[model samples]
Target: MIDLLKEKQAVLDVQPAQSGASFAPVLPVDIEARAVSKRFGDTPIFSDVSFRLARGEATALVGANGTGKSTLLRCLMGLIPTSGGSVHLLGQQANTATGRELRNMRAQVGLVSQKHNLVPRLSVLSNVVHGLLGRRPGMRHWSQALAPQSSRDAAMQALERVGLADFANRRADRLSGGQSQRVAIARAIVSAPKVLFADEPCASLDPSAGEDVMELFFQLVRDEAVTVVFTSHNIEHALKYGDRVLGLAQGRIQLDATAASLSAAELRGLYD
Candidate 1:
């Protein structure tokens, strides 16, 4: 059963599940920020920031507070417009795409933030089902009670991936900090998104809980072969979980290096 699930998951991740299995090819460059820049009024947030994320790549965005890491992330996701340059996602010009086109592109993307953002009154299963809203809308997705069987099953599979299947029926408010974060991760991956964007995802947890959640989160990301772009205040996480590190400082990309080639000390220097 485990092997079967693994095989099925690879298909959801757009990879070939097994020998001779049909596959969908993701573009070589999943995300590209071409000299993008942002500003709020006269205050510049970031300028000339650019990077490309390949399919299934994991990159970490690291920086000191107020360097606009979050702003840059939002721009990359097309949640906000860049002041200059452009962002391309999944073969479309994200910033220039039509409304429907942008929505369609975003349907294949997922997000996880520091806050769990779960509906406290709802069951964990229902919260996970909500991740499908970008693709599956209307009252049917409002709760597990109204959700179709297929939706429920997908939500459960996502819960299982985060090791929270047993808590599917529990209320979202009844979970521990670590458990809530797990549910958040399950929600993000429920749609088998081509790319996952996480902004300080562990920022709200204590050290011990944060460490545990980050481990589980990255492990699941690897198992599903998902591309990821996450911002981290923790240098250890930046080096440990990412294939490449994109550092922000002085209103620009101060450092862009392979994580394998970057020492912790060198990355820490960017924070100074």
Candidate 2:
């Protein structure tokens, strides 16, 4: 299955740039979650979970299943209301932001989930171009396309970064799982978002593919200065790729440390 995806990806036209580019934030973010908590009726997910992601840093959220990792991501994105405390993104309160405020805030962050979330019938290029939806809301349809040439050019360039530019004309559903994930990464980064949130980005991939995807993510972080926050179940990958790892258990952060400083015993204790 992986080999087939790689073959289908061969058709993509990746347009490498003359020189790599960097994304410097106009105002750097000190993302902080202060005493945040969440609950579903009688079930509590977290209590007083606090942490911060300094600008230009990559943080890995690691935990066993059903530990509220996804819920925390949604909370950071303001998709759901928090039961207590607050989430600050780029210094803006996430939970209380209004519709327009939320939209503006969301424009600064890009999300890539385990699911590609692409329209199956849409062309790969079209799906990538949809990354501009937050920027060009007026051009909602393929027929009514109004994105500037620069935006399209950027999207194509992003595809190239992920090595999938040639698949631009193919339907999204035709690509393999790995290829689709690559496309999703391109879409997330094309917008030059200040923060990139990836939820279990390599969850469905085999070991090799998972490493490749994680390497690509780190490359983006180093090359583009895009702050990344991702959830991962793999402890080795977290230690290898993450500058810092936050281990979550029972809705709260159990261990937060630099990868080099984290020991196997400490990591094992996080799950206990």
Candidate 3:
């Protein structure tokens, strides 16, 4: 029965960039959560959530609003402490890493939040150049005027990939919402980090612009083999863009399966 469904749906996006490559098993679990939990004071946001992903894979996180999707992402990134259990990132323990070790671990990953997170006064190029802060970590790369020519070049190359190089010198405040999101994506990919996390990156844009951004995003990251984990409310997107689908509902992972192994109807059921 599962084989018949798989043949009927024609799943998309597992190994999207390299269509010829087989959907191999996820081994080595570069990112993992073991019985993780989160709370705000006495209010438990979630409990006992756990999953794992391999390098170069893409997973889509979906759940009803207030299910703690964003909070869970932060925990995995080591931005906040988990209430209980453990998270492993790049073979390093997330909760116990020292200050320097924590910084080093974060440097290997990228994040594109729902908000653009760009400095309004800075130029578009400068915002993208900030992606290198994880690697550069100094006053030198703070702005285009102070950054070395090499950094500027790398920033420009990233903008070019997103087709935004011409706007490199424009003030970030002047761009439209869609354009701002594109710059955000450029910033996320500029470092070519091993992992990328996006929290509803296109939620603010119109449908057309959002579609374009998602396409451009997948194209760039998959080409670089950057492992991706993004949260989205769109069910079709979960089915279409992720190698795996993880559904969070009632404060736990209610569904865990490959995109190809699941159908849109199955995902929608998780919402209620």
Candidate 4:
């Protein structure tokens, strides 16, 4: 017999399931930022910030506006060069890597920005297939427009995992904010990255929608056992969802502790 009550309960619950698979003991990935600094010509945005992100963990970076959070993410992603020091991803020196090497490194890392980066003109399935583009070295422009049947199947599965399978044929730009965010997440995970970086993923959503999106993120991290690092301005959300909370002020890490370890008062001090 079908259990209607259980199905209904599943729809209401937002908490992610705990990881049950035991990961093999491997050398921890050393994601380190050593004395990193950034500047736009003469205007310095951040200076002498350093931190390390260990493998197989979730870390939340929290701060006020203009605290260099986005700049730090860009630096980590190697989108922009830092003025001083360096960033190392999985033990590879990001500062010295060539374009090809950097692209290789980026393949292992996934990013979901505040602004959804989906191709508006494409169908939802096509946008998800973009995750596979990093794997195809020579495929680009019009040549890559027609995704293979296998890739299309994979994209459909990804959308199904995010509960958007029914909308696979819809245009990405036509979806609601929450649905768009889920599609963005589906695209990120389709590549099966080792680490996922989200920059204020729920910044534009309403309270309920934000919670729904965050719930999906947590589920992805736990189910896939992918390392997650995100930046957010929402303290309550950080406290509720983050495994490890990092408070950044003035472009430096001021507090690093488990979410359970930080009291409300302590969190306020970090923000202040």
Best by TM-score: 3
lDDT of each: 0.89, 0.81, 0.88, 0.79
Off by over 4 Å in 2: 1-28, 140-146
Flag regions of model 3 displaced more than 4 Å: 1-26
lDDT accuracy of residue 118 in candidate 3: 95
Where does candidate 3 have its weakest 10-residue lDDT segment? 4-13
Q: Which pairs clash (backbone N, Cα, C closer than 3 Å) in model 3? A: none
Question: Which candidate number has the best lDDT?
Answer: 1
Q: How many clashing residue pairs, candidate 3?
A: 0
- Candidate 3 lDDT over 173-264, as tens digits, reads 99998899999999988887898999998898899989998998999888988888999998888888999988888888777778987778
lDDT of 1 by residue, 1-272 (tens): 22333343344446444666665675599999999999999999989988889988899999999999999989888898889999998888888887889889999999999999999999999999999988987899999999999999999999998889999999999999889999999999998899999999999999999999889888988987888999999999999999988888889887777788667877777777
TM match of model 2 to true structure = 0.86
Residue-level lDDT tens digits of model 2 in 74-177: 99888899999999997789999988888888988899998889888978888888887776666642411455777778888999999998998889999998
Model 3 residue 204 distance off true place after TM-score fit, in angstroms: 0.6
Please give the distance, in angstroms, between residue 197's alpha carbon in candidate 1 and its true position after superposition. 0.5
What is the TM-score of each predicted model, taking all chains together?
0.89, 0.86, 0.90, 0.85
lDDT of 3 at 229: 92
